[model samples]
Each structure stands twice: as structure tokens, then as C-alpha cells.
Target chain A: MLRALSVIVICGTAAMASSQSNPPNETRSSPATVVPQQQTPTKSTAIIGLDGVKEKTAGTLNVKDGKLCFVHSRNKSQISAAAIADVVTGEDSQRVIRGTLGTLSMFAPYESGRAISMLRSKIDILTIQYRDDDGGLHGVIFTMPVGAAEPIKQELITQGAHTTIQTAAVAARGKQ
Target chain B: MTNFFRITMCSCLFAMLSLAGPHLHAQRKDTEKIKASALKVEMIQSDQIAVPAAFQVAVYENLIQQLGKKASFLHVYRDGDRDAASIPNLVVLHTTVSRFKEGSEEMRQVTTVAGATSITIHCRFTSADGKLLLEKDVNGKVRFFGDNRKATYDFAKRASAVVSDKFSANGQS
Candidate 1:
């Protein structure tokens, strides 16, 4: 009886050991299984173009203060807000500025910093308007990086926009 | 012997799995970080104004000429009247200060004076309406032998060149 009991004890121990090594055939949850759950989702905002503003394939979209903001990813350095001066919505969305030649050249000093300084340029606040795909309109305030304002303005003119180059003092406080 | 072998195999498998977890997690985190740093700028509009007075106008016009077709000038009073008027891409404020003296000493003193005078212009740029695009204070020493127009013209020309270079570099029209 003592020998028989010893064999039974050894057999039971072997079975338990085998079970522990292979785990259970049923789904055995591990502490490691919860690790994936620990990862949190990261959210980012993007700006998308709508309606009159032709949407570029590579860009981002975001809504700020109730206005839709569209940013083209190709020129990652350029950022425009929904509000710009003289935004016209029709078949195409356009921003218009009316001033004399002197005003146009006034941007020189701001541009100076661009050439000599590493700091990003700051543009004054202008009005911007958004036209939705379904013909809805939204307006927002916007600022551009310095130096970029002129090129965009020029492009608008070249596109047959009636750009009026005007003269005025430098931007005044609270004017932008 | 069977029990001992089973125990050894389980321990080896756990150890390998544990080692791989951190590397996989780290790789994912790195990818998320890269997507956060990109930014872009979009332009809206610009307005520029010229300094009044004939000497200033002469100086300003000479400067505008250097800007080529990139910029133009207008009288300040008519800036707001939008009767089929074109909007300026930028606005420039020009002022001329004359100090009669000889050589660099005169220029140095004028620089200090000009610097003080520029505070108002700087403030305007900071303001919402002025939207001061650029400001350049040019000091001309009205020499007995030198033409003030020429001196002012030279200063405006240099400033315009600097501004134009910046505009082009920024990808402005």
C-alpha cells in the first residue's frame, strides 16, 4: 500500500507540472494581456478646405472658434485662418486687400526679420471667410506668417484679381 | 524528469515574451511623436502706406522703383475708399529725418534719434488696423554738397531691397 501511494503521489505531481507548463487549453488571461489596454489614443486636429476653397489632397483641417481652418501640408510653414481681409466666396474663394503701393511695400521691415532672424514672422489679423461644400458661409479671424503675405497677394493679382495697392501707416495697435 | 523539463520550458517562454514587449511599445511611441511637430502658414492680405511730403514722396517713389512691381504707394486719406481699388499686398511706412553733419558721426547720432522716433511706427505694426507690414527709418544728413533727395532715395532704395528680398524668400507675391 505504501509503494502504491508513492506512485499515485508522483503521477499527480507530474500532471500538475505539465498543466502549468502548457497553460490551460481554454483562454488563460495573463497580466500581459492588459498591457495593450494601457495605451491611450492620441488625437490631433487638422484643417480641411470646403466649398469655394478647393481642397488640396495633402492638407489638414480643424475648427477654431466656430470657423473651419484649412492648412496645406505641402507648404507646412504656411498657416491661414478663416478670417482674412476681403474674402470673396463664389466659384473660388479669394482674399482681397485694398491699399496703395506704399502700403504694399510697408511689409519690408517685417520681411527683414525673415532674412536675418531665425524667428518665424508674424502677420496682422485679417478677415477670412469660409464657403462650405453645400454653399454655407463662415468667417473667422486669421494671421499669416510674415513674408508669405506678399507672395500670396501677388498670386491673387496675377490671377486677375483687382488688387489695389494703397498707402497707410504701419499697422496700428488693436487694428489687426 | 518530466516535471523538471516542463518547468524549464515555461520559464524560458515567459522570459522571451516579456523581453519583446518593451521594444514594441517604444517603437509605437516614437511614431506618434513625429506626427506632432509639423506646422504651416497661410496668407490673407496686406496694405502699405507711403510717407507724405514731396521729399518723402521722392524718397518713397525712388524706393518703390527699386521694389519693381512688387509694391506701390497711395495717399493715406484715400486708403479706406474702396472704389474699384486694388488691395495692397503689404504696407510700408517711410519717414525722413535730416541732421546736417559730416561723415559717420552725423550718421551715428541720427541712428540714435531715428531709433527713438521709430517707437510709434513699431507700435503701429503691433496694432490691429495699421497691420504695419514693415518700417524703415532712413536718416539723411542734408550736406551742403549732398542732395537730400539723393540721400533719402539711397536709404529708401536699400530698405526696399531688403524688404523685397524678404518678401521673395517668404514666397510672397
Candidate 2:
């Protein structure tokens, strides 16, 4: 359903971009495709959040009856099509270290503090780029269970998306 | 279908569609935007704290990350960018860590199933004209998992919640 809106937006923005002399500065940071005038709610258990931050709650990202909804904590955001310039998604890993250290301490692999420092990692991250009604470019990212997010991710990409994978940070962690 | 039934059905559908929109009734929404709050968030600064550089870096990066997550601003820049501040109608943010607790994760694992780590941030939102729009002490705490930097994430959310409430003319918070 979100992808449906993206297609509409892309068609609209393409038309507008041709007639206009200068595109709004906001759309320049990332790919800004013209998007739907409305959105509806979607269903599925995936972590969702806004801009470059993903909240803890896991749910679907969709537009329900014209309202942009990310279920789980039931966060509903209102952004008009005119407010948005594009929608893009990508993978992000914001690592954390609490769990890895607690267990690693038992084995005494190395120094406890160093082990903890090396282990921190982000489980999942879903990044999005958008423009608001005022044409201010913005982004929101989410993280979800890798197993379950395939469908949701594919749908958004097929609808019109630019995808990038974060470089593996494990090497850096190992070096540390 | 009977003519009366068909007509009645069409009218009902039309009523539902019209009811769904204010524009359909010719009621124009108040689109007037408050210019003062329509700011491009440029620089975010925080007072130096006597904490681990790693923790401070986490907090700083998280705050910038959270602010960038909002799809409202035309642009959001990091601290080192000197040129962003020169833009018109720029909004600058200042934060200070008034209270901090470097919780021991080892103590947490040994003591109980959950541990407490937290940080309190006093955030100030100011415009180019030197007007203070929001000043709030936001708290971030992580109990079971993650590290003290989790406190930074919580603080970022809490601070953004406060700032967005007052900053967006559309009430984006």
C-alpha cells in the first residue's frame, strides 16, 4: 500500500519537475520522487520509526484510509503528498554491546572492557528519505527482524526506491 | 435494482465520500504557516561533560541522528559545519548533560535480571533572533540491555519530542 502511494508520487513529481524552472532545494539531499496525495495503514511485525531513527516498537508501515500509520506503538504521522518529495529505503546497523558482553565475560576471551567495546552493534536499521509538505527534505529509518522484512523491503524498492547496504562493521569491531 | 434503491445507494456513497473530506464541503483549511518556526536546523552544540569520549560521541551522534530522522527540515547539519549557521532563519540547539550515571553492566548482570543506566539532558532551542522557544530537561534510560549510550538514544527521543512540539508550525511532534 505504501508502494502504491510511491508510484503515484513518482508520476506526479515527474510532471511537476518538467514544468518548474528550479526544483526545491530540499529534494536535493536524496532522491525525491513525487509521491501519493494520500496513504493507508499496513500490517506486519517490523520495527518502524521516523527520519533516521527507529523506535523500539515493531509493526507495519502503511497508510490506512489516507492516514500514514506505523503500528506496534500505534504511531500515526500526518504528512501530505505536497509535503513529501520522495521516499527511499536502505539498511542501517546501529550496533549496541550489552548482551554480547554479559556472556563473553564468562569465557574470559580477553579483557572484559575490551571485549565489551568490540561487541556493541545495531541489530537492524531501515532508512528512509522524504520531503515534507513545505518541500523540506527529511529522512526516517527503521530496523526490523531480518527474517520478516523481506516482503516489506521488496515492495518499497519495487515501487521506486534506491537501496544501499552498510559496510560490515564486524572488522572494525574486531580491530577494536 | 429498483430506481429508488439505486438512487438511494448513490446518494449514500456520495455522502460518505463528502463526509471524508473537508475540502469537499468547500471548507478550506488554514494553510497559513508560521514563518518563524519554519527553520532549517543547522547546528547542534552541547557543553563539554566529564564523561568518556565514547559515551559523549554516542550521545552526540544519536542526537544528530534523531534530529535528521524528522522528515520536516530542509536540512540538518552536524556540529563542525560552520557554513550551516549562516543560512537564513536557522535554528540552533544547545544541550547540557546536567546529570549522569555510568551504570556498571557487570553489576547489573551479577545483581539482577535488569540494570539501570540513564542520563538527563537540559536542552535549549533557540532561533537566529536569540529567542528561546523550548528549554526542557529530557531523560533517557536503558534497563535490561544495551550500554550507557542507550541513555543517549532515549535522551535524543525525549529532546526531539520537546523540540518538535514547538518548532513545527504544523504541530509535527
Candidate 3:
């Protein structure tokens, strides 16, 4: 009778221990490390295309330890360089003055609004498509100075990112 | 008597055939409609308007997400996805921003009537062979609350609503 009681207690303890050992997967499946976006000290605007981080953040982006990281304020987000499937770059232009000033300028009298619209500055856009741990595809787009995105693309390619279009070819396509 | 019975059987068979013919035709039409329900969202184009890169990207991404949630396309394909080419009755969506006004969040919060962000996109849905399906000019606006990017979300929702109202998805209207 004592042996039977001992066996029952032992089985219950083992079952409880096994159940506790398998924790629930409540955490999201994303890259573990974070990376910065700006290569230089000046931070650029980065719009993260991931599920959680979907806002336009001002940050410095860089490739550190084979990961593309974006450091904004106190937060950091990264994706593995090897996981990037495609890199596409585009060139566009925006008004010289932006935000509230730009929008308000549209209300200027007569042809002033039209003339202010003509004062445009060229910009570069970089888009990166990468996969997460679960093999889910994600994309990110960031805009920088006219000549900034090309070097970043080169750095990403050197660090194992993939791209189908050459830098010059992309520039030409954007022109078209 | 045998001849009369044969005649009667022939009449009954013809009656059944006539009754079932319209039903079969309707079913075939439904099948064709479902086949054309597959949709592929192309990247938003801003060649005409000087839309910010962020707004362009936001529109494209939000449209894809909203279509999946609101519309019932058999399969939704992203831009440049290779698998979309082989789809038999794929519909491609092309969006061009006609007008965009970037508003200030602080201004909107301070003076709700003053700062209003608005976007107007010309959405064109076409077949795989470049045949036009449906085209409409949709407008989205954020008058009071939320960021300027919320206009993109509004535009996506309205576009998906248009698609859902027009196209039959998964054999249901």
C-alpha cells in the first residue's frame, strides 16, 4: 500500500514538472537583435514595415554584426542582413519646405502657391524586403538625402543582402 | 401501347433537361466570376504627384492589408510577386496619387478646423491582359484626429469597400 502511494505522488510531480517546463509561446517571432539605420551621425527618417513597428521613426541605420539595425531615440530594431531578399531604390522629389509650412504655402495668394510647389528638392528612397524567423515576408522603406541611399545599399549588399537591380539601373528606372 | 409509352418517356426526359439547363448555366457563371476574383495589388505610383515616399509606401502596404481583411479575394498577391503571373483571372490594382496635403499633428490638435490632411488617389483595376475592370477616384481624409498616414488607411478601407461591393469573392457577392 505504501509503495502504491509513493508511485502516485511521484507521477503527479513529474507531470507537473513537465507541464511547467513547456512555456507558452506568447512572444512575437521576430529578429532578436536591433540595428541602426543611419551610417553617419545624422539620423534619417525610417518607416518600419514590420507588424509591431509601423511608424515613421527618425533613426540612424547601420549594419552591425551582420544585422541591419535602426536606432531611434532609446529604441533599437534590427533584421539579419542575410534574411533580406530584395533591395529596391527609388528617387523622388518633395517641396523645399515641408510639414505645416509646406501645406500652409498652398494657401498663398495667386500663383505663389504654384511657384512654391516648384521649389522641390530631390530625395532617395530605399526599400528592403526581408523574412523573419517564421519565414514571413516583411518590407521596410526609408528616405534619406539625395546621395545617401546608394552607399547604404552597397553596404547592405556587401553584408549579404540581395538585390536584383544594379544601382545605376535603378537610378535610370527612377528617371523613367 | 408500347409506342405511346416510349413517347411519354421522351417527353419526360425533355422536360427534365429544360428544367436543369438554366440552373447549370447560372452555376457556370458563378464559377467564372470566382475564377476572376484573384487580385494582385501593385505598388502605388506617384509619378504625377510629388507624394512623399513614406506616403506612397504606406498606401501600398495598407491597401494590401485592408484587402485581405475586408475583401474576399481568393488570393492576394503583392507587387512583383512571381506567382501572380500564372494566375488565370488575376486583377491588378494600380493607384496614382493625384493630390496630397501633409498636415501638422500639433496644429490639428490645437486647432481642429485648421489642419486637415487629405489624399486623392485614382484607383484602376485591370485584368491580367490589361483590360479595364473598374476604375474610380477615391478620396481619403483625416480632419481632426490621428496622424497624416491615417489618410492612407482610410483610402485603403474605401478602396477595399469598392472592391467588395463590385467583385464577387469565393462564390459570394
Q: Best candidate, TM-score-wise? A: 3
TM-score of chain B of 2: 0.66
In order of DockQ, best first, we have: 3, 2, 1
Docking quality band of candidate 1, CAPRI definitions? incorrect
Which lDDT tens digits does candidate 2 get at residues A67-144?
334655545454332333223233222323334654565444323332233332223234444454443334444444
lDDT of all predictions, in order shown? 0.32, 0.49, 0.70
Model 3 C-alpha lDDT versus the unseen true structure: 0.70
Q: On residues B1-173, what C-alpha lDDT tens digit does candidate 3 reach at each position?
A: 99999999999999999999999989776545333558888777788778765577678778878888887555777776777787877889888888888875445644558678899999998999999987899988898756677899899999988877767655444
RMSD (Å) per prediction: 36.8, 24.7, 20.8
Candidate 1 backbone overlaps, count: 72
Query: Which should have the higher DockQ, number 2 or number 3?
Result: 3
What C-alpha lDDT does candidate 2 achieve relative to the native structure? 0.49
lDDT of 3 at A8: 59
TM-score of chain A of each: 0.24, 0.38, 0.67
Off by over 4 Å in 1: A1-176, B1-54, B69-128, B140-146, B169-173
Error of 3 at A5 (Å): 74
Share of native interface contacts recovered by each model: 0.00, 0.00, 0.04
On the 0 to 100 scale, the lDDT of residue B122 in model 1 is: 17
- lDDT for each residue of candidate 1 in A1-176, tens digit (9 for 90 to 100): 65565565445544543443342224333222221111121111121223233312334433333233345534332223222223321110111221253234324332321111111112222223333333322333333322223333323323333222311211221166
